[model samples]
Target chain A: MARVNATPRRRGAARTDELLEVTLELAVEVGYAGLSIEAVARRAGVGKHTIYRRWPSKAALLLDALSRVWTADLNYRGTGDVRADLREQFLRSAPALATTPIGPVYRAVIAEAQSDEALRATLHEMFLANVEQSTLDRITRAQQAGELVPDVDLTFAAEVLCGALYYRGLLSTRPIDEAAVDSLLDMFMAAYGA
Target chain B: MARVNATPRRRGAARTDELLEVTLELAVEVGYAGLSIEAVARRAGVGKHTIYRRWPSKAALLLDALSRVWTADLNYRGTGDVRADLREQFLRSAPALATTPIGPVYRAVIAEAQSDEALRATLHEMFLANVEQSTLDRITRAQQAGELVPDVDLTFAAEVLCGALYYRGLLSTRPIDEAAVDSLLDMFMAAYGA
Candidate 1:
């Protein structure tokens, strides 16, 4: 009886995952300039109202799709050592550079945000806030554990981590590989670690 | 006779400077979206032909105008110490944040660069090359002076410095102040200085 009930649940989950995957593939193919709710609905084989029921606008749908596609490994705790934890986190997340269309999508969004106030606010609230909060949480925990220097400014440190990653992503065409991540971790630790 | 010739030379230089200033002002008001060579010529009180004689196209004119306007003081010589040199260089350049529309203009150019491949290559060659070159020069000098660590990757260090500044400028409306510059220098030194 339990196995029978699990069949429907698994099917539902698979359907949702398929929808998200289709949305991401469309975003990459058309760029953000060509993204529309109706287009996403058509591409995903889902109804316009169905997509609208889950996401209010194209921006909301894009954000939702991004969240589903670009899942970072938040479990970066490694032997309670901050440096190792950061290196591991960066390495795991770094592969998204090749697998996802996140870099180009982010650039397109930022470009539009320059002229569109609503998109700007949405980007700040959805993307920037998520990155900032997660980084701060990790750094603050490290500080409390005496792994980071007592006097290190947690906010600035958080900015440095995200800023470096963002800088590499936007400016360069190269993938953010393990070597770059390792060097960044080493630099950050040398600068702020206790 | 000498006095008359000197007066004419001084006036010509002053007029050229005024034209450049007006060009930047017009760019900010209209953006790259609506900017035209004729408009710039009218705004600067110069003949359209004269503008074209100097620059073949509107893009060329804007590039020349930007070159005259966006001047960073790259006189950072090694003080026989990498940390101090980095600190001084950042401190000196920090105040230009308020005095110039570099951030907005740069964002505009970068956005335009995405679609216009020719303009993109020209922008990289005319503007970005100088920035990268100056940064690498500083790092190279520091390396030669034995101020930087033997294994320090100058390319990565240069990226970290300029990349952080570009990141903040493009992503946020926040002013990059002296304190922020100081913190950045501190971190850079901690990471790369011997």
Candidate 2:
């Protein structure tokens, strides 16, 4: 009886994965503007209600698809050097943003969030806030370790470092290449380095 | 003879202004997703061909509308203080972005550009490039004036300064208020100050 009950739960989880996979595939091919629930359902061979029952809107569906695959490993190595660690994190994550479907999909969500207050808040709570908090934690650790200026508020510093990259990469349409990262780090070192 | 020739020219310019005004009104009310050429033409009371003749696409029409009204005065009031000049420019421009239709419209265009390559290039060329150039110019002048560190690349410095504000104001949904400005300026002073 226990096995019989668990079988249905396992099947449900697999269905969720299949739906999310289909969502990402459609998102990459058609983009946010071109994507729709009917289209996704058609491609996935599932009823539109199946998707709607799970996700209220396209944006919500995309967010889930992104959350599943867009796991940017923010594990700071704490290699005894803050600047190198930051540079490592950025360089390591560059390919995830630039080369993958996550890049375009993520950009679309951010674009949609401009006019969407609720989506914006959800995005912040689900994604950006966590990235920011991790960055802040690393910065705080660096300050404690005497690699950064002690007792000075590093709130703006964290924002600037992360914000500048987002600006160049997303806003300015500039490629966030190695050179750009180096230049950003140089400015960071000058500002926050002990 | 001169007056007769100028009559058509003046009327054409007036008609253009009226069309653009209608476009802004519709954009603010419905937003980018709900906006369309059919609606714009119906509201403007002009035939669809009339708008199509002038603008190849909705993105083009919105760009023109934005360029006309989004005249952010970037003339850095060179008080020989680089930090103060930047702070003044940011603070002065805050309301123009935060309170006006320019803010929402600009955000919409930036959002659309993520999917449209040609539109992205046009936006960068028409708007963001000028802003970045002027910022670089101001920074160069500051470096020359010895108010900032000399011989530094200052390229990333400029991007970071401008980019940070853009990130906070647009991407992160944070207000570019006085306190935020103060914190950014503090980081700038700590990093690049002579």
Could you give candidate 1's per-residue lDDT for residues A21-40 as a string of tens digits? Answer: 77777878898889888887
**B1-194: candidate 2 lDDT, tens digit per residue:** 99999999999899888888888889888887677888889998999899999988787787777766756656778888888888888888766555656677778888887767787877776776767777888989998988888888877777787788877766666789888999988887788888
Best by lDDT: 2
Cα RMSD of all models vs. native, in order, equals 5.4, 4.9
Per-residue CA lDDT of model 1 for B60-168, tens digit only, reads 6676677776565556756676666666776666554334465466567667655555676677566655666677788888877777777666776676676677666
TM-score attained by chain A of model 1: 0.76
lDDT of 1 at A7: 98
| DockQ of candidate 2 relative to the true structure | 0.57
- Candidate 1 accuracy as lDDT: 0.70
Residue B46 Cα positional deviation in candidate 2, in Å, after optimal superposition: 11
Q: Rate the local accuracy (lDDT) of all candidates.
A: 0.70, 0.80
For the predicted complex of model 1, DockQ is 0.34
